[model samples]
Each structure stands twice: as structure tokens, then as C-alpha cells.
Target: MDRERLIRYLSLLVIGVAAVLPFVLEANLYLLNVLILMLIFIIFSSSWNLLAYSGQGSLGHAAFFGIGGYASTLIAVQSGLSPYVTIFLGGAIAAGIGVLIGLTCVRLKEWFLAMVTFGFAIIVQAITVSFLASLTGGWDGIASPRLVSSQVPGYILIEYYSILAITAGVILLIYLIFKSKIGMAFLAIRENEIEARVSGVDPVRYKLLAFAISAGLAGVAGALEIHYFGYITPEIYGIDISFWPIIYTILGGLGTIAGPVVGTVVLTILWDGLKVFGLTYERYIIIGAILILSVIFLPKGLVSLPDKIAGWWKRRQKKSPDAGT
Candidate 1:
């Protein structure tokens, strides 16, 4: 990784440890559960950023998320496999589906591509809902197999650290990819697809590659959820979940690496805090208001808030440096 990204990864790792430190010391289930949810969403939002930054607007992201959840959960429950193996199996399965979808749809432009992806998501959800007896549990969903099956759970701390380690690894991987040659190429595509094509860039290959990567990351997030929450339902694969990454990405900031992470933490905390008030639906209401205000005032996202505030302060300092003095 580059110097900047190395520092970011290190910082995230430290913060992740700190976030789970409560569980390590006293095993606060509430805090641990919240942290798990935040990190899972962070992974989801980060991967979605990859595809969005590449200029591919996929509306079926939850398709991969759901697929991963089911794949890992099924392996763990039915086959009695280890969690470690199932995680990767989930990601790989999602990646294969992503590649197929990407290859088929990447050639299209704008709304067509988005619509196609949206349709794919609906189809997946339908299949999950319909096949109650076999692959999916239908509308009822299935109970997840336990990753840690013991009541005492001696190595709970180990599990916490494992999640921290995996999340850090994923962040580092995304950082490296964004800093690579292909990442820059993806940015070029985002800037102007026609120009990128004119410059002899094969839009199909790079876009497909991005789709595979993005989908794989989403799969990882789903796998984590299944293990952490111990449940899988058709709701997990619906369009609502797909919209989450987009919402979080926009809330945090687009085109910035740290944006999604910031967005995930802030929104998750707000949502959790609001739940105690019994105004559960109000969380979305607040989020919607924030989204609107953000678009109106800070189009770039909350990440840009700092920069904007800093710039304003600098200008004021220049204009009235000695007024008070």
C-alpha cells in the first residue's frame, strides 16, 4: 500500500480494536452486536463504492449480499462446515455470479444498465421466496447455523479479534486496489465512458472485473451478517439492502476512501440511539432529511464537510485576522 493508505489501514485497525475492546474486557453483548453490524455495513458500503466509483451503477447489489448469506449459512448448517471455509465459498459464489452479470450488462449505457441490475435483484429475491423447500427458505427464511455453538464460549475475544482482523484486511485490500493501475483506469472510465472506449480501453473487461470485486466484497459482508446474526431471510436479498450501500456511500462522501466508513459509523449510531425512543421508522425519516440537506448543502457528502469548513475558516482568517487583535 501507498503511504497514505498504509496510514489509513493502520488507523482503521486501531479504531476497530478500540471499538471491540468493550467486549474483550466485559463481554458487553449489546456493544459487540452493534459493532458487528457497523463493520458489516462498512464492508458492504466500501465494496459498493468500488463499483460506483468505476461508473457502474448497479441496483442489484443485494443480490450478491443475499447469495453470500445463503451460501455460507447453508454450508455451515447443512454440511456442518467450518465458518472460515464458508466465508470464502460465499465470496467466490457471488464473484462468479457477478462476473456473469457484469459481462452481460457492462456493454450497456446509463439507465439500461441500472434497470437491468435492478431487474436481476428482483429476480433473485423472487427465486429465494419461491424455493422454500430447497435452496432458499422462501418467505419464512431460515435460522442460521451457529458459528460459536457453545454457551460458555471461551474464545469470544478471539472471535472479536478475528472479525477485526478480517475487516482490516478487507479495507487494506480495497486501498491497494484503489491505488493500483487498474483503479486509475476505472476512474478514467467513470469520468467519461465514451472517451475511455475511444482511448482503446476495453470497457467490458475492466467493468466486469470491478463488478466481480465489488460483488465479492458484498458477499463477505453477507457472510459476516449470517454468522453474526445467525439468520437468513428473503428480506436479506431485497432491493432495500442493496440501496444501503448507496445511501451510506452518499452520506459519507463519494469518491473518497474513508467516506463510507465514516457514514456507516455515524448513521449506525444514530439509528441505534433512535431505536430506544421507540421511533424506529423515524430513523429513516431522519436519514432522509439528512440526505436531502446533504444534497442541498454538501453535495460531495459529510467527508467534504471538513474541507468546506476548513476553507471557510481560512478565508475568514485572511479577511479579518487583525480585527479582534
Candidate 2:
């Protein structure tokens, strides 16, 4: 079969498995909770990948992530709107802020842009705790409404399925975006900004649009997470939160739709699996080692592993024939 056809089938198989996972696991709340969080990170990681696709790397995505969670929580608390409604509103807010951030970043590239974004996260966290502490509740944090109240029967199951649906929808939306003309423009800008501009694709406008969309999606992931946990804190903007998506995207495959999903799932499993062995701080060291190894051996990320193996096997087969001759 052709590559595209194989990919399509594989994607459908993955969706099928995800759909049946609840029953396969017998609706275990702990596992469901992990799955839910994994799905959220998939969204988050995909958002980061989208920005990277535009050739902008951010080190402070937690800024948008926390902004979304806080905005959604605050709006839900004051307006008495459903968490569902407030999530989108919060994402919109993040998108607006992202556009502003993008304005300062469009001319910058690589680590310079990364440092600026990293600075924003710190600035945002400080503001959340010090200036917006009245509403944000400072480091103490504030309660958030659950996506589905625990009072409901099988609420955990409901929450899992809800999050799963949202995750699928987000991935689908991203897939569409990646296949569109806008996606082509993003690719052009990433490869060569001068060439893109000469070809009539405005780098500045597209970069800003990329920032807005990526941040908005990240906001949704953050909103989902806080609502799921039923709390929000300045800790939502922590450095680890910002780094997780970058790690997941890089490990899976940068600038690919399935890369985030594949990377998040693999790492989440490895992370939790290690926890079972009572390794806490040590797990980070192990994970770091694995990431380094993957970079050195499979720089295209796990998604490229199969192709790499296949090519290696073909080369070995060819060498063996020559050896016999």
C-alpha cells in the first residue's frame, strides 16, 4: 500500500483502540485519569508542534496554558457559565495575548525567540501571583468546577469520554489545518522566510496567526486540565508544564501531526511505569537519558523508527548478497 494509505489505516486503528480503551481497562478510575491527562497533553503537545511548524520555538508555552486555565476558571466562577463554555472563551483570551506576543517574536528566530517566550511565562506567573492574586488567589490557588460533577453516576467515565472526544476533535482540526493552504504557507515560512515573502506569503501575518491558533489550542488543553482536577494555581504556569510539550513533540517527531500523540503516549507510559518501581527523582534522570539517546540515534523521533529499521534491514540484505558473492 502507499504511504498515505498506510498512514490513514494506522490512524483509524489508533482511534479505534482509543475508543475501546475504557472497556478494555474496565473503567478503572486511576487509569482513566491517566488517560485523560495523557489526552490533554496530546492537545498541548500538538499545539507546541504547530508553533514549531511555523519555525517558532517557544520556551514559555505555560504562559498560554496558565492563562487559559485561569481565564476559564475565573469566568466560570463569576459568570456562572459552564466550564465547557468558559474553556473556549479562555482560549480566545489566550489567542489575543498570543498575537501580541507574536508581534515581538516574528522578527526573532531560534533561541532568541525561545528566551523571549520563556521570559513571558515568568512574567505571567509573577503577575498571576502578585498582581492578579485577588482573583487568582495567589499561590494558594482557587477551586474550579469539574467538567462533570462527581455527584453524577460514573462521572469519571463521563469525564474520560468527554476529554477523549475533545482530544479527537482538536487533532482533527489540526489535521485539517495542516492540510490546508495556510499549512503550505507555514511550511514555506519555516523553510525560508525570505523565499516565502518573495513568493507572496507574508511571514509576519502567518506567524501571528500561527501563534494565535497554537496558543488558543493550548489554552483549551489547560482549561480541560484544571477543570478535570477541580483546581487552579499559579503552579499551572510552572517551568515543567512548559517543557513537557516540547519534550513530547521532540520525542515523537517535530512538525508532524501524529508525532505529538505518539510521543506523549510513549513517554507517559514510560513515566508512569517507572513510578511503579518507586523511582521519583531518578525517573527524570532516566527519561533524560532516553531522550538523549533517541536524539542521537533517531533524530526524526520515534515516528521515524520504523522507516529507519526498514532501511537498515534492506542495507544488510544487500551487504549479505555481496558477502556471499
**After TM-score superposition, what is the CA distance of residue 35 in candidate 2 from its true location, in Å?**
0.5
List, residue by residue over 1-325, the lDDT tens digit for candidate 1. Answer: 4966776676767676666576475877777778767878888999899898899888889999988888888877778898777987898888889999888787787799889988888888887777544766678788886556547465455556666667777877888888897898798899998798898877778899999999998988888888777788888877789898888888899877888888888888888888888896778898799889988998898988877999999889889959556
Error of 2 at 269 (Å): 0.4
lDDT of 1 at 246: 87
- Candidate 1, which segments miss by more than 4 Å at Cα? 1-20, 23-25, 152-156, 198-200, 321-325
Query: Which 10-residue window in model 1 sums to the lowest lDDT?
Result: 150-159
Best by lDDT: 2
Task: Report model 2's TM-score to 2 decimal places.
Answer: 0.97
Alpha carbon lDDT of each predicted model: 0.82, 0.94
Q: Please, what's the RMSD in Å of model 2?
A: 1.5
lDDT of model number 1: 0.82
TM-score of each: 0.90, 0.97
Clash-forming residue pairs, model 1: none
Supply the global lDDT for candidate 2: 0.94
**For model 1, how many clashes?**
0
